[model samples]
Target chain A: MADNEFLGNVGGRTLSKPPTPGDIFFDKSFRFLTRAFTWATIFLLAFIVYKIGGKALPAFPDLGIKFLFTSVWNSSENVYGILPQIWGTIYSSFLALILGGFFGITIAIFITQDFLPYKVEFALKNIIELLAAIPSVVYGLWGIYVLVPLIRPLANFLHEYLGWIPFFSTRLSGLGLLPAVLVLSIMILPTVAAISQDAFKAIPHKTKEAAFGMGTTRWEAILRVMLPTASGGIFGALVLGFGRALGETMALAMLVGSMSTLTLSFFAPADTIAALLANTFPEANVGLETGALMYAACVLLLITLIVNIAGAVIVTKATPGGDRR
Target chain B: MSQTGLQLPQLERQPMEPRALKSIILSAITIACAITACIPLFSVLILLIYRGGKRLTLELFYTLPPGAFDAHGVGGFGNAILGTAFMVGIAGLISIPFGILAAVYLAELDPHSKISETARFCAKTMTGLPSIIAGVFAYAVVVLVMGHYSSWAGGIALSLLMIPTVMLTAEEAIKMVPNPMREAAYGMGCTPAQSLVKVILPVAMPGIITGVVLAVARAAGETAPLLFTALFSESWLSPNNPTASLAVLIYNWSSSPYENLIELAWAASLILVVLVFVLNIISRSMGGKTKL
Candidate 1:
């Protein structure tokens, strides 16, 4: 071993170590190159966020607190505030979350439980994944034409029956917050169900059996034991779904009426931050408009960042305390 | 101690009793929601077939969007399709190598390295950045730098959209390569790079290909990024010139005031959805077969 390590060249001079064919390529230059490339990618990403945000930072010394409160958004007047867009995005996305969370959790339970035959369960799982594969544009197109018409009657009916409520008071517009909420719900459902399924499948079989052994009914076992065990995962799924709904673009842009004005009625025209950017960026005629859009982009970026970090935390906490067999 | 201290006779495990009718109703409702999530897709396909079927002849594949309402009903998505393929190809070309390298840097060399961690955070953040945000960023970077919105600019934006997904997938694929293979390679005096390229990469090729295909499918259906960077074109297909893609074309036609335009939009959307669906099925099957 010592001889092998202190090898000599063919001329018989003692050497420190013999170089192998693989190590031949791992020179100082290659190492430096690899490190440089790695750093470059990192820098490029940071630069993108910065460049998208650089101009917006200067507009508000105090991080645009007042700009966020102002209700007007008249480009010709050089007046731009995002209060309406913020309220609209949050309200609609929250509605989507509430609706999607209920539906997604229920569906997940049904598919994972023993009520269905194994073949039927497998087919349903495949269908769920395939549902996710459909393109967002297809959803948008369908929303614009078919869904809009189909829901118009419902919107009018609601307006008539529930007009006392602030959110349902407006004249029914087929394309507005309600449709957007529905689309967002659909878009987020697959994500929530898929992730929740992973969590459900991970629950210990023994625990479930024990719950059943206690003469607990199937419903009681699922509700009392399985659901709580998977709560962290269910939270992760909600956060991930929120992230997706917050950033959804073409679908929202196409269906949600692009009115920047705020209204209490969910049936009124509205604009989300994402949909606003989609509509305005293409036609941005001046620097400030562009900067404002960048500011909006930065806001979207922050939301996504928070959502992802929170999701990661929940998922990590959900990992078993270590019986790593 | 009942005389013999014998344990009470154990109760037999019973088969699950039938659920209450309400519970059955709840389960049916849950299944309906799953089906509801699929309704838009189903309705769109049915609508497309109803409207575009008669007009979706072979001639529709060879003509351009007619300028006048009645000039030529037989419109081809030739430019849009070619443009989409070309742009997606360029995006895949740019993303895969860089993304794979980033994944390798993350998993193989230093799991806790600051650079890799920062790279990972950025990638995750970018994954949730709306495609429109990416489009705006690309506009600032590519369009501003090049002095015009072009196909090249669109390609850059789509690459940005694609890189994070590819990086995440590649990292998962690479992590699945058993560490013992890497150790064996090193025992034979192989360096990390040699071990990766000669042994690890080949073992992980199926997974990597699956990731790439899925990424391409994602890029192909993206409309928001292309909107700002590659504005629509009417008559010609040019890889060098500013061009619209199938997604963008569908957007334009669907939103136009003309009925014919709307019909063409449905047709194009049908084609795009089918293309994406096929790619998804392939990648999904590949995922099942190659999963470690």
Candidate 2:
């Protein structure tokens, strides 16, 4: 133990401290340790870029822009094009976003509107957040064993009756873009709703009072005033959810039929970037196959970066009192 | 105007009828959507019980997976259950210390520095990085060097996935420690380091523990990040050996073309969900407002 020494008088009393040598040693070492861990955050991002980029570089020269535009993939031929997968990612995410965003916002309104009992609202919200905690793998299992079987008949019904429409034209396998979209929508709802709920709650109480004072009904107040006021934050939340849907892997991989193709029919099976990596990285022969998978991952990373950045921008501009401002 | 006086008085006395009708429909829509949104959660639980309950047997936990042709549906998934625990335990060990320290730097040491901001931003953004990227990165770094897939690499990948969640949550916990606690420590001539370790940390322990539990739950259910890192195996797992996890096992089994494998998948799913659901309930009850 370091010897105690008189450091100061009258913090209303005399104060003792460790000797200067021990203090210096402890402070220096502690600071260095904390600094390294803190910088680990930065180092983490750089390392990801370095590792993925290093592996992806081999494919870039060989495929270039062609990689993004072509759809065929066969490891046996060492030929790969990710166009179909890209379409699958975008198409499914957009479909999921449209569904999740609409319902998520509505759910936010339902839970936050003060009509339900406090305990019920609280419990419901917790249950919804549990959706976020459920492993994607479990979700995949549920989709395959339960959701697919239940939806197969409905899909077939859609196909048989609505064959005139392109989306419903193809025979339903129950494990195609439609099921993938539904699963993603269900998966993302909590994210969208939670953040939207936060935005809705943050609107000044006085705004609600003002709307009511103007003779606006409960629905009028929520739709006309509340929705517009929180639209920026709501949009941000939706983008976040959509980004999540795109990155969703295990469930989509298991449910999306693992096919590589671009088709307008929602009944067709499809693939996404994250699902592709999850499905292929294990078996990737250490050559071009690995490079292509890494390239696909890089593309997914780029998409998330764009979405996150754009979300930040929209939220900052739209929200009344954003943190950055 | 002929009826202006009559119309004005009626408007003042009553709500707009059409508007009221429209509001009613919209309100119903909101409520309907809320119920619709909640259907998936309850349905998943109900179906899991219905299907997995029939397949649940004591042997499922004791025996290796039965092959697809087994008519009896005989074996258990003891290996996967234990493997998940071991891998996530190692991941928690790796992430917890670094996460706490990084959080301490953010909360106490230099909260406003550029590097601190970079750390905060990266941690925030990294939370959204696809789990597959973490898997690929781990494979690139650990598997490539080790010349094979291993549980060590899987744990490392899970640790990366966990660090952001742990750091941000711990930062919140530590920041919640009252300023007066630190001031009192300093009044006793304690240094910033002393105040942090002796006063702030103890005060923040509950919230930090909550964060740790949630992070563990998060890591335990992870499947994507372990794909290329842990790979998969049916046998008992060693830290340096390929191992199967409950999540991965469920994935492989559910996807198998055989009905028996699918039954095993449901049984595993039931166990995994129950474990995760319990952990999440504990975490939420501890910190009702903790960030997701």
Candidate 3:
């Protein structure tokens, strides 16, 4: 009460308050709560690992090691192979990365340039951010109705011109790996663009001007200094986009055609691990079906874990003040 | 000049300098890419609206799903709207306090400990956790244990997905609070807990709320995690019943064999997008106001 009274009165002179039993309990409990919250994350991570592993163990005895390489997915036979889905996930993710990385960087580089007016910059940034906010399912719905139909003619055109190329040789079905890749790219563009924009923006103005002062043109300055300086952050952005593409579910499920086999042509239908889980989960009878499904999910878990860890490390390292941290 | 040299120089003259061409090309690429990048954005919005707009009705929002044979996009998806709200709301209730407390622990109590670093890394990695895996975890823990799929399981999965995002952003918000505020609170003979609640937390409230809102947006948009955990129901989803969600409705209807249901799917997609976009805008503007 004295301390409370002292705090109420300004210029009360430096006064130390005696800790009361109630105050001590309150402080200890507060500490306990925060500590518990902190540990909850670590515990959650372990619990996820344990839950997936526990469920997946039932399938391990049935499928053995062949589960990774086998592509045939007959649930009745107690055979579940995720190889095709694995390949599809990796292939589409990288393809999306290339698309997202290219267009996303282009957008980032575009906005970072000094010549662009503020109005244009603001609008461009807004679009990219809005693109990020659009739900994956929304993107999926759009891809199903609009993008796939548009891709059909383009697929025919490519087949007519580049039929000999394995990547473009598959029959011209509108819904396939290519549509999924395209959608994935569009989905991740905002991620790459935003990160790179922030990284480029974080650059010191003098560093950029110094390049210009040395008789370099705008292109030369950007290429020589700005890009090189922000390369770490840019790579982090790319990886971030790749990780997103890998884990993307609803959109790719709708667009990727759900073909179960691995094929070289980009025009073929395919299933990512996520798509497979989403599409088959409802119909997956019981016992081995569910267990193997969880197993596939476990694989996705490991992959995302590594990717996200790497992204986190990269991002932390690339932060402007990471050296101090 | 000698006649031969003068003639050759005049004949070989180029229209623009190489440096000029390089700058022009670079500028063109940047502007061109920015403009072209917009194609997908415009296309997605226009197509979704064109496809989804005609199907929306007040009945779609107010009533429960008609039986499968009953026609139109109206009435059926009302359950989904409420279910998503229920699950995400419950998730927000569970996660926000825990996330903020963890963030405060990192930012104020122990900024540089190894445990804190490890916790930070775990939270970062959790951001990239595949939503499907979260579903499986919830299915195993809640759905299986409860003997059926329920909204509670769905909320738990969403909470798991949301905590990392909420925690990381909350950490950033807490750290952003000026040190002087904390010192002043302490100087007033306040305990550490009092300082945290009375001074530091108030200063950080805007940013923390923004983070929580973003987490809610993410949980609301998610489909994969809810698939196994919540499952789907065509009827009204009371707290004890199986849940319906807009994302799952969009997924199911878009792929259905029936034409009308597909139309309904588009309408549902539109509603879902609008909801997510509104939440996104709110969280963004909230952060923007804080100048963070």
Enumerate the candidates' DockQ scores in order.
0.46, 0.68, 0.68
Tens-digit lDDT string for candidate 3 (B126-241): 88888888888888899889898899999999999899889988888888888788889888877888788888888898888899988888888899888888888888877776
Which of candidates 1 and 3 reaches a greater TM-score?
A: 3
- After superposition, candidate 3 runs with Cα above 4 Å error: A1-17, A323-325, B1-15, B72-74
Segments of candidate 2 deviating more than 4 angstroms? A1-15, A18-20, A316-325, B1-16, B288-292
Q: Which ten residues in a row have the lowest lDDT in candidate 1 chain B?
A: B13-22
Candidate 2 versus truth, CA RMSD in Å, comes to 4.0
Q: What TM-score fits each model? A: 0.89, 0.93, 0.93
Q: Note the B-chain TM-score for every model.
A: 0.88, 0.93, 0.91
Clashing pairs in 2: B60-B76, B60-B77
Residue pairs with colliding backbones in model 1 are B63-B76
User: By DockQ thresholds, what CAPRI class is model 3?
Assistant: medium
lDDT (tens digit, per residue) of candidate 1 on B1-292: 3667777764653344354444455556767876775565567668867766756767666677776466446567778888898899889888888788777777677767888777776776677767887787788888888888789889989998888888877777887889899999888766677777788878877777788888888899999899889988886777666896999888777788877778888888778878887898888878876677
Model 2 lDDT tens row, A170-259? 876768988888889998999999888888988989998999999888898998999998988899898888888878888898888879
Candidate 3 versus the native: TM-score? 0.93
**Local distance difference test values of all predictions, in order:** 0.78, 0.85, 0.85
Q: What CA RMSD would candidate 1 show?
A: 4.8
Q: Please tell me how candidate 2 rates in CAPRI terms.
A: medium
